[model samples]
Target: MMSDVLKNCHHRWKTLNQRWSLQTRLLYINMLLVGLMALGISVAYYTLTRYDKKQQSRERLNIAFKIMQDDFQERL
Candidate 1:
């Protein structure tokens, strides 16, 4: 099964090589690499932003709790 898939891939690659110039193949390869890198960077950025937002929310909640506690003590 694996060999069949490999054969198929080799055939496709051969066909592409025959149809496209070397420069065109290189251009496509570079574009694919750049696109993958961009996707990775964007995902990392999104994850970091989400973590930062959660941290900020947790800090805000703690501050609010502290204020309520102080106010209650004053009333007593």
Candidate 2:
């Protein structure tokens, strides 16, 4: 079943290749590559920003906890 689907896809791709001009095909391929690269960069940036924010949040919590502890120690 999978093989049949793959063969159908291959047939369609060959038909499309034959129908499109060389310049058109190259333009499409270049656009696809650029789009993929842009998507990768965007995802990486988002991941790093999220990680940095999480680290900052954790640091803030630790600072607050230390302040509370210091106050308790002084009172005791």
Q: What's the TM-score of each model vs. the native?
A: 0.80, 0.80
Q: Kindly state the number of residue pairs that clash in model 2.
A: 0
Q: Deviation in angstroms for 52 in model 2?
A: 0.4
Model 2: lDDT of residue 20: 100
Tens digits of lDDT, candidate 2, 1-76: 9999999999999999899999998999999999999999999999999999999999999999999999999999
Give lDDT: candidate 2, residue 23. Answer: 97
Q: Write the per-residue lDDT of candidate 1 for residues 1-76, one digit (tens) a residue.
A: 9999999999999997899998998999999999999999999999999999999999999999999999999999
Model 1 segments beyond 4 Å from truth? 1-12
Badly placed stretches (over 4 Å) of model 2 are: 1-11
The pairs that clash in candidate 2 are none
Clashes of 1: 0
Where is the poorest 10-residue window by lDDT in model 1? 16-25
